[model samples]
Target: MLDDTLKSQLKAYLEKVTQPFEIVASLDDGAKSQELHGLLTDIASLSDKISLNLYGQDSRRPSFALNRPDQDMGIVFAGIPMGHEFTSLVLALLQVGGHPPKVTDEVIEQIKGLDDALHFETYYSLSCQNCPDVVQALNLMAVLNPNVSHVAIDGALFQDEVEERQVMSVPSIYLNGQLFDQGRMSLEQILAKVDTGAARREAAKLNDKPSFDVLVVGGGPAGASAAIYAARKGIRTGVAAERFGGQVMDTMAIENFISVPHTEGPKMAAALEEHVKEYEVDIMNLQRAVKLVPATQPGGEHEVQLESGASLKSKTLILATGARWREMNVPGEADYRNKGVAYCPHCDGPLFKGKRVAVIGGGNSGVEAAIDLAGIVGRVTLIEFMDEMRADAVLQKKLKSLPNVDIILGARTTEVNGDGTRVNGLTFEERASGEIKRLDLEGIFVQIGLIPNTEWLRGSLVEMSERGEIITDAHGTTSVPGIFAAGDVTTVPYKQIIIAMGEGSKAALGAFDHLIRS
Candidate 1:
């Protein structure tokens, strides 16, 4: 298995590398040292098609990068492929050899048709053992289709990036240019978001506005709930949102909300809308509040202007505008969106049943979605670019226990793949080994992070957090008198529907009190 030239080169290199390591063998019998020597020898004997290199510390890992000759399969080994790490090592090597372990044929076909470049970046920590499931989901998706690619970043290694990206927790995914999801996800759930992101990006380029009283800017659960409560209070309310339903719409389900055992983001949004319509809330969907110049006061009423050349006067104003998904702005992501793209699992998971899907991010949401989709899809793959998962210890334990989950550390998605009709696959490059491989998948789910949508009111009377989240008092009052804000747009700890609804109701009542007093 060892050619003379390659063997000599590896032998010479290992002599220096393994000096500090525990050497179980010499140039004679097969032991730890000899095994490593043999592995390197095999790498050298392989054809030029295989790209092998070292990652991490040369003194420690001394791994290799393997690339298949025909398929876009590849692997980057950071440590010796034996013992506890052997399964991961062998499986990764097999995937590079065009033999993905358990992906179904249907999922593979769906992935093959994808020509777009799917790029994903996953973030996690080494301390998180529950991260493997998310990685496996992405891998299955990649195996079935070779168009999508993935990258797993170790949070501890990229400390600067983690802080710069505002990664508050583990298991965060980024799809295309924006933060997709921020928790656990399944293969199908990941695919669903990819399709939804594609559809919206293709058709949703602008925001159209309409008329109403007490116009609310954000559309998070709080803002939507505010509109509903305001309408119920016999107040004419107009809710304008850049993305309807705000942060809650991006969530997969709601477990803590009262009166509902479990509810998905879109379902909760729809119900809230229905309730609002029962009163008198006019929803201006897909419209963003780009400007918020306080209208000239007349008869003690305050008026505001909109970017769409519209103006409205109301006795009170509620800034319920929510947040936006953060973006990576990395190369290749924008060119192949929707082809093998995504952002929200609850919005599009069903489209990828029995299909391979990738969930990027190593946070709670990323883990949760991956687990949920595993039950319905043929396979679920998760890619965390971080060294470990940082989810709550309990949740992390559950993720590790899943049967179909896979985890990849120190990798990143460099491209997306699709053939125009839908998504096909992805390409991943190892940050440490510099090995690039393509994965085929029907869909991808991104769970990166959220950005508060407060750009319009940057210099306004409202105070804001560093992340652009609106700042509010205990009573939902903004810095400006007669102005109140609530929901995801504000700096609330738990961004849930029930919490938003309660906050929105409180803001509406606060506005009413202000109006009465004024």
Candidate 2:
């Protein structure tokens, strides 16, 4: 049963649904099925426009019997939808109940015009904040086109299929039996994959030789800021990235972006892209920088080779490649990722509000996460593998002041224990006594360290720190004259969004200075 606040909100939303829609539950007499039935019944009770139907496996209708033979429009709930996925279920109902898809008109027209049969199978976990975006997008796509059909499967309920497909993360999408994408993706990205044949041919025939005055290697917050600043100078600027938004996309809520009180990662990422598009900056998405060849002469252009058999040349370069979170490589850790194990505390902390959680590592990041989560969650357990905590004295003092926080030192995480659905507990061993203990927790945040995305820069002239971070000066200038580094990938003292944006601006100004002097 939902709380009064949530039920009120859902009832209000359902009341606005004008069209009639049916939610079908395909299950036998099982506890999971019974729970799902109850949830659907409650949802259906909100409005007369919504109806709930139940069918056993033997009586289930074939996919071909639906509106479109090639597609199945029957919305089925195979298991209980809780956590973030509850939003997916509600949104699906609203979308199917006559709410228009929140996409561009051209995109809608393109989807409507498609005649080929397209089916999508998306696997998601209830706790994964990012999974709902992909699930909702695919569901909306199905609603928009008769030729397109989609099934949103809870990964925990379908562990066999997950293991068969080797899915280690949430929002693992498969199109027509082939893996399309494994993480959060926009609707346009999914459409591109649907037209894979045409896209491949187009990519092969693309022969345009691109050149720029200043080229940014990454499309994260830092790189986006650099490109925006450089483009404001009216110079040819280009930004290439594996994806825009970088680590920000994985983050949930961002409150420290300066001036803005609170914002989500995906929202901020979209804003960054929208702001960048306002300028004349050339954006290349889904492109990875493979190699960097520095210029031979002072004013000569440097070449950036890409993994996609494309190249871009520029007089100055800004390496804004971002960093990723370090993982805890223990049993069930990868399997339960997004299910219960998470990395970005800011993004996922609110999801675990009033629940018991744990923080791995006793470093500053771990301590900070514990402090932040203690206010929201009921209880927080801080575990350190070392004999003592490595966080600062001030942070330690603050942590000690928190009554809800429990600290355990010299504790090594042995394994993450969970049902096939979500994490319930974890096993840890004390170093001194070799005694094993278990803590029943709803979620675990791993914040040991960060690894810079600078592996491709190996053997290059750019100097790197012992930890592989790109060494940069106060002005964001690297060892090479025309090259500059910024953001978490560089030797910056902090890795905040505001700090990265400032560094990006500094790097862009530095590049402009070098370009004019040359």
Candidate 3:
């Protein structure tokens, strides 16, 4: 629509303005470096449209600030925006442009009123894939409210620092000097913690540790449900965990969970914890169990040593150690995992809405994810190493029915292709055909399998399955007396949260049985 003269003038202006912009590249052309650089270069060359570019390449600090050049913003391209990163970029761009983005006014007021400074240092790995959002959120806090700063340290990049800080888990955040929140924390919850830290400490100091007849390990649905049912039975119980939510903490959103049509992982975890808190039980949060030893006598008591060096003696022990997602273990896969690689479709599916994605696996989880993603993403590529799907016929049919879903059978994933910042595509080879195909996708959801969190109990009192699942009796009793097992870590067929909770309740009752018999 513009005249030739005007178009030339605009081109000249763009050329002049882009001369001063700096391009920060982490890798050589080996990655999508050139493509990303070109994209960023083009975006940065836009007019003063207040485009906020929140850079997520900082491998240290839970979150940090990146100020644009004197020229007001152009286009906002968040490199690692999923997980906490997306939230952070949105908030950062808002603050840098001096215009608040689309959020409730009440939320804005709460953020503005915060005056005290709180810093959250979270140790996370790119492979975690769920940790980026938490980091992004903290970054947003740094922008919206001046009182808080978040720094995310890449667990792999900052191995020495993580070891020094004693951070063994992803999304392990320290508020100020003391540990504040770990795992996925909501903005409201984070604000409350910082606002009520002193008050909470003072109040907790006054309250005495509640006595319990049984001590349950883990606090996912299984542990939380167990605690609640035990309280209902008038039994004193205590639930301990490194992180209160357990494996479910990494979930983005849970749609398959019964009763609730849809629920976020953090919300579900908070609700469960709140329910247990209503009971008279000692809730030990942010504590890890180091070792479990048998009672000194025939059936006196079991001693649980904690990572904090604190010990808890209980008549009964419930091992609810759950399972952790397996990593791809391929090059560039770990580097760009959360950046583009993900494990749980339930947790990260919403972000990939309308985008091309590939689900890696042929089992029930993979087929379910492919079917689920077909509804959200533009295209769903289901890759299986076997000749056919390993999932139920119903799910396989559902997955195949989706027009956008593509099935690549007998294909094994060889490498996850990325541009160093986010996943661009994946490479796989057909076992029977021996033909290799590279898929270009915006995201990849890995549903290979889960590894049980029962390695620590190898030489101890419990037996584990060939798949690393803990063996438990009908009542949740383990091989050792006074010891019980529950949840996904147990040899149960189902790994649902509701099932875990039900088993946890059964384990609590079984522990009570043993305690009374003793």
Candidate 4:
């Protein structure tokens, strides 16, 4: 299944294996099984430390386990780990073969100390950009802790399990036999959930941090840029974020970043974090900022409070909290979220295969989602609130050419209909005819847009727009002195990743200029 070039690359990577491991497969005589057999054969041929075996006794057919010859490590791939999961497979091999993982010693120790007999099964899609992180993290944990076992399953290939579990989303994790979490999660986040005392320990550590000269409140492109710029000035810089990468982590394809022709969200986010780490920035990921307290006296530090009960003070604070996916407030929308309502087409599109689904909104995201869904789903109904689609001409043309797609303009989504468990259909009002219509579908994909993450600033000293966006001047400085805002969280017109980064850098410069003047 791999080309000659890929073979050469795999051989180079496999040479780093310091110990011997076996790829034991229990594949039946199916198409995917044969394909997986070929992939394993190619991989095993590249490394003398690697050995391949078939016809194992695993209950899940077309699956394999990576383990030492003497022991079962309990790290299993229940489906063919290709596409986005190919990287997970490679990492599993390297780690199982005794190559050290690229994780902090502290985190590695935490994983080793876990004594719970936890078994994790994650349902994932091949096209999902968010699944690899969850799969690889669990794989590493299983490799580290003998009490932990993880099974990475491809949802599309295992339709029976997907349907039985009602998994409408990718990266749906189950602990033991119950649902644990859905969507993207970091290794730290997973550890926090499993390790009970991890949160209190993290909070205590965060609370002990000293005051920073320039403090950034987000970890998106803008926040990363700001942190880097501030740290370069030989100042103490710190970044506290709900999760590094912000909304950019949910993004699939980013083509218009200038010079970089193609990149995924996770890859770009990783690069941003790596760049910031090159400086003296102290990054605190998975930290949510809930309140902002302005400095009472001039030339004093402002305080930013986190949901974890940790507070950070800074001379100048840069707010780059960015935005989140806007949701329809209609009835049943919230109730059915992840039950049948989804946001990313690339992540959840596979579960809706051979079923009817609807895409809400007619902007670029909505149109692109419809076009992508048309290939996998049985039918796609695109509904828009405006009379005309806001998508570009090229996308509109492609969407119109798809035979399995239908577009409805001037329609407002009224209510989402579901049978208490999952979405069944939706009701919309036609603007032109004043007629209420219902779409009978299995899923609804919301692709309207984003809303700034500045609700915590309300009633505070910070000036805000009617849309709840933080108001900022040309310098990225907010209404309050010594408090600057940038990225989508501010009053910036465009919300592109590149624009956010530039604005972040500008905000850092503005903060520095203010510090010098003070």
C-alpha lDDT values of all predictions:
0.60, 0.80, 0.68, 0.94
In model 1, how large is the Cα lDDT of residue 13? 39
Give the range where candidate 3 is weakest over 10 consecutive residues by summed lDDT.
Answer: 72-81
Candidate 2 accuracy as lDDT: 0.80
lDDT of 2 by residue, 225-279 (tens): 9999999999999998888999888876688778999987877888999999999
Better of 2 and 3 by TM-score: 2
Q: What is the TM-score of each predicted model, taking all chains together?
A: 0.52, 0.72, 0.61, 0.99
Residue-wise C-alpha lDDT for candidate 3, range 20-105, written one tens digit per residue: 33323232333333444544444344545424243435443222334445542222222333344433433444455454445568
- In candidate 2, what residue range of length 10 has the lowest lDDT sum? 60-69
lDDT of 1 by residue, 1-518 (tens): 44578456544433332112111111233254356666654743443333433232322233343444444432333324442233343444445544435645644555565666666666654333323334445555554556666555554444556557755344567766568776556454466456555324323322233334477776677877778777777767777665565566555557878877886665676577667667667665545466665544532455555554445556678988766565545454565453346565543454455678888777887787787667656677777788777567887788778787776767787777776545678788888899998778877777767777677786676788888887888889987777788877789787756777889989988887776566
Please list all clashing residue pairs in model 2, or write none if there are none: 252-347
Off by over 4 Å in 4: none
In order, how many clashes per candidate?
103, 1, 21, 0
Q: Candidate 3 versus the native: TM-score?
A: 0.61
State the lDDT at 99 in candidate 3.
Answer: 49
* Candidate 2: residue 165 Cα off by (Å): 9.3
TM-score of 4: 0.99
User: How many backbone clashes are present in model 3?
Assistant: 21
Question: Is 1 or 2 the stronger prediction by lDDT?
Answer: 2
Residue 277 miss distance in model 2 (angstroms): 2.2
